[model samples]
Target chain A: MNKPTVLIIDDEPQIRKLLEINLSSKGYAVRHAESGKEGLLLASSHFPDAILLDLGLPDMSGHEVLRQLREWYSRAIVILSVQNGEADIVNALENGANDYLTKPFRVGELLARLRSAIRHSDASTVVQTVETGQLEIDLMARVVRRAGEIQKLTSTEYNLLALLARNEGRVLTHQFLLKEVWGISFQSETQYLRVFIAQIRKKIEDDPNRPVHIITESGVGYRFQ
Target chain B: MAAVKLHPFWQFLIGTASIALLAMVCYALGDSMDQWAVALILLAAVSVLAVLFDIIPVLAAALLSALLLNIFFIDPIPDYKIRDTESALLFFIYLFIALVNAVLTNRLRKQEKKIRDREEKEKTIKLYNTLLNSLSHELKTPIATIIGSIDTLKEIDPEIGSQQRMELLAEMEIAGNRLNKQVENLMNMSRLETGTLKLKRDWCDVNELIFLVIQKLPATDTIRIRFEPDESLPLVKLDGGLIETAVYALVHNATRYTPKQTPIEIVTTYNKENNLLIDVLDSGLGIPETEISHVFEKFYRLPNSGTGGSGLGLSIAKGFVEAHGGTVCVANQAQGGALFRIVLPVEISRLHV
Candidate 1:
């Protein structure tokens, strides 16, 4: 099997080095570029499986680079930016970046988000139930079950659960879930994400108090187990 | 109201009229009067004109006095020639005396005016300093409260879930305390700047004052305050309430920054030479090295420091200390933490009522 290749375009030498070491340790081939100009040339010529781009670049912006890449290639683009404001995050995701990560992000969290983005690109599966032991999420038939019993969910709740279950075991940030499920503008509505995630857990998880599926990462976002 | 002149013409006319009157008096009275008596009258009249009219030049007064004494008061009477050698010698003597007096008085007045101008400038600068320091210090507390609470909320529940609702209420309490501190600083700053920091000075026990400060700290149980007063020292005369406020600010700052586990040391010692010194030391991230110089500067937060504090703590402490004729200094300790030393004069007479 060919190695899964990832391209990283970040201005900071330390960040690029750290990502390269961590990603390669997980058995992925990693390539790098220091500027948006070099990133564009590399992405077009090399055609890597996915690209991690920093929105703040010295020569050119990551938004422009993402726009240029979306013009031709149907490749996964994840935006890694230190610009943590709500509007900037929403705008980046709206401009066709598949995922976003704020700077000072924990190494483990970033890797989890990367896995979800990669899984999303490789297999675009849209059918049937994803069951692990007591939990069952049937996407095609539009039903969810726990411990061999059917559970009811709202249309929004069903959509949210299906999205998370489809990419289960990969971390989904608050911004990513809101953008994917509710649209780009809902990225800043953390309250909505929290309330609905609670409602879903209450219906599916054996103990809502100690959730086994959806987990909250303080000062960061959420992830599904 | 009279119209004020833009030109010097009115001033020149006044000078000319005063000079002509002095000349007429000398001419009319010169022959019957002794040369000394006539010159004395002319000198007196010129001095009055200089003071009253505010336009006659000192040089004009000297010149007019000299011409009158030489032409009219001399023995020559109405003639240009002197009656004798004695008369010519006396004429020069009177002229020299009058000229010397006028020049000395003018130089003295100039010196007095310069001193008066400098004193006024000093007064204005002092008032400006008080106003600026107080205003910045006053605004700092509330702004810190609002920002700190918001940051805490973001930290505790980025998602704002039902389980973390209790944390939000506690965050609001912290913010409220910050706002209250700010309003108090504003009121104190205004009262102090207006020359109204009236001390209700009395002979009070130093230990009680220290205890009062400790009572004001949040989570008071966590802090270990050590107040050691000298046994040989006499009872101190101070504004008990004001000094307590100053000590409260110091203790609060020390407790806030110190690791929740570290002990705080507050000590008081009396020196025969420098009077009394009280030191408050904490083992927190000491005021940053750069901020040590400006800890007393109003509203100046240390670079890269936490945003929870109002930045007015040390400035208000300094104000209260200085108002009682005391000196305050801050520095970081080598072992760790910050030390604030306040020196107060043992001699109570140094404080202004």
Candidate 2:
């Protein structure tokens, strides 16, 4: 398999150097963009699997760059900003950013998010079948079974469960889950997701109160294992 | 105060012309009207001129009118002599009234101008006091933490474990971020105050925005925040940076006030009117009934609530939301928490697939 390519678009030399060293050490092919304009050009030319963008840039605002990129680029664009303001992060994500990491973020957390983004972007990884604990999900057949018994799930519940089971161990944000399962319009209906998650937990877990399969990353999202 | 720029030559000419015209009219009507009536009319003219003209022009008008009254209407025509005692008394009273009216009117004008200036100065002083009071604590706390942690890391024993070193670094990071947040709040407050905060409106996905906010905040193992977004909610056009700052402030405030490990919930929905409603609810000690209205006032902290914040967060949130043509309000939830609700209007076209 070819090594995944990552792009770092940041004006700060130190930040770029740090990310480059860390990503390169992890055996991933890395590219760099010093400014938003350059970042856009490189993103188009290379079509990197994932793009790490900084909100503050020299030539143009990082927001404008993300806006232009989202117009054409369908791949993941994770924002790395020194601005920890909720509005800044929200704006970036709402504008089509895949994830966000504030400055001084742990290297471990950054790598995990980058890996998840890249994994989601790769079309080949849409696995046909996923088996975790006592649960079995067949994406092709659109069926879920537990302990050799076919479990009854509504179409929406099945889709929600299937999405979580496929991307096992990676935390799927409520927004991402809603968008993927219920479409873009339903991305904010978190209550629907909660109800579905509870239903799925009851069906798949030995104890619904203490779910071992679907874990809630409080104030963040849900991760399935 | 700047001097009232009245051309002296013009004002004097107008004042002289007005007095001469009044004298001619009074002389023409001398046969039908009495001297006292004429004198009263001339005094009234001086008072009218005082209201419209500067002090110098009004004084010139008043003096000219008095002299004209004496020469043209006070018993002896075209002369300064006053033979009748009653006529003399009338003449003196008319002059006294004109001079008093001019002086008193000018004094009143000056007093009004002083009051206006004082009000403006008081407003500015109040703003500065609020900023300075909040900054003393906001800016100092983070800096003090950063300095103390750095000193410990540098001067402390080299035998400190890696874990201890990491903890020190984390402290410094948190302190530095806190300092940065305070600075950001200050800048945002300044922008709001100066009316320079330009909204860079864009089509925003509300779900993504909320998730991003939650993600950016340092996840505390104690506070459990759940974000519930409406599935049918449309894309909103807003300055994402500003709205996110506002929502974050609310969440941060929730975390700060609530006990550790308490639950804070964020709920977003598209109302019937196509407006986006975001609710940040915290299972903490709810705001006092009397203090709810004052919560958004700059530097307003609940009395006796010993919390560590600049108290600019809620006000900043209010400023940001209002900038977007939205309204943010707080209420004590019946279920035991404070609810901050933000409602933003979303254009129909902005909603999409």
Candidate 3:
């Protein structure tokens, strides 16, 4: 398989160099764009699997670059900014960013988020069946089974469960889940997701109160094993 | 001393006005009122003037009232001589009481003013002491670590393993970051104190903000943070930078005080009243009742907690939230932990679908 391509847009040479060294060593192709304008030009010419953007670019505002890139490019775009503030992250995410990581982040963590973003974008071509312990979900059949028995699930519950199952072992943020299952209009309606999750947990787990298949990440979202 | 000394002319004018007013009222009511009633009315007027005016003015009012009582209300009207013993005793008592009331009221006012001034001075001194104490420790520790590690790396033998060298470098990095954070907090506190912070308002998603806060925090294996986002929460208009820093400060505070492996839960919700609520709760030792009120005070730390902080975290958090017309408060959870809640009143026009 050809290595996944990553575009790095940042003004800091040391950071770009560090990322290139680390990402290249991990069998990934890395490209660099030093400014927002350069980044836009390069992105239009040759698309990468993921674009790592810096919010504070020298030529133009990083937010503006992101806005323009998102106008056409639909693939994963991860933000790597030094702002490290909630508003910056939220704005980037709302503007169609797949993931966000602050500067001085651990390479291991960054790699994981990158892989998740890439997987999320390429989810259509990935595996159709997800299995965790006693729980099995067959996306092709639209059926969920536990302990070799088919368990009945509502369509909404199935959609919620499938979204969580597809991102196995990865945390699916609440906003992402709500957007995927209930549409963008219902992204902030967390109670609907919680009620659906509880129903799914009840049908699939041996003990719903002490769930094993679905885990709650508290202030975050949900994670499926 | 000159400022404190009242002008005799003005004092006389005030005293004469107060007495004249009382005399006029008494004279008007003398047709229906008895002598004793008139005397009591004069005494009450003297007491009221004593409470409202300076000591000199009050004393003058009292003397004038006493002289009127003796001249008009005595058994022999308009006579300086007193024929009866009871009448004489009453006149003397009235004069003594008026003078005593004036002096006592003035003394009480001065004492109250002194106590208030002293309390204000002590509060300021305490705040400065806390700042200095925390600053000395917070700044010196990071600087010392950086210096010590760098000195070791420089003088060490060339044969040292690269891994060891890398470890030292990491130590320096951590120290440097800690120092940077302390300085940032100090600057933020200064901005809050000097009222120089400008709010850059934007629509904010609470869920994304919490995730970023968790992501920005150093990856910890021991402390787990769970964020439950409200599905129906509307995007709130806020100074996103300030609110983010405030929330980060609260979470950082919980991490420092809470024990390892304890869960810190951040939950967000929105009500019909257009207020966004965010709660950061920790399942650790709860704050003592006595310290709960002071938790957000500038440079105030829980006594003997031994946690390393400049005591500006919560204060800055509070300052930032309040800047957005919001309030941040802390309370001990019933099940043993601390709960910090931030309620921001958002404008409905700023909420987008």
Using lDDT, rank the candidates from best to worst.
2, 3, 1
Clashes of each: 0, 11, 12
Best by DockQ: 2
Better of 1 and 2 by TM-score: 2
Indicate the residue-level lDDT of A82 in model 3: 52
TM-score of 2: 0.54
Q: Of the true interface contacts, what fraction does each candidate have?
A: 0.00, 0.00, 0.00
**lDDT per residue, candidate 2, A1-225, as tens digits?**
788899999999999899999999998899999999999999999999899999989999999999999999988788887643445776677677877787767898899888877777666775888887788888899988888788999888888888887877566677788899999998866657766776787788886645778876543467777
Better of 1 and 2 by DockQ: 2
- Candidate 3 lDDT, tens digit per residue, B190-270? 888899888866555566567557766878922388876564666666766678789899998898888877899998888
lDDT of 2 by residue, B120-177 (tens): 9998799789878778877888788888888888887487888999988888888887
Error of 3 at A51 (Å): 0.8
Candidates' chain B TM-scores in the order shown: 0.53, 0.67, 0.75
Judge candidate 1 at residue A198 and give its lDDT.
63
lDDT of 3: 0.81
What docking tier does model 3 reach? incorrect
lDDT per residue for candidate 1 within B179-243, as digits (tens), equals 66766766676667687777655444455456546656665633476655453444567766677
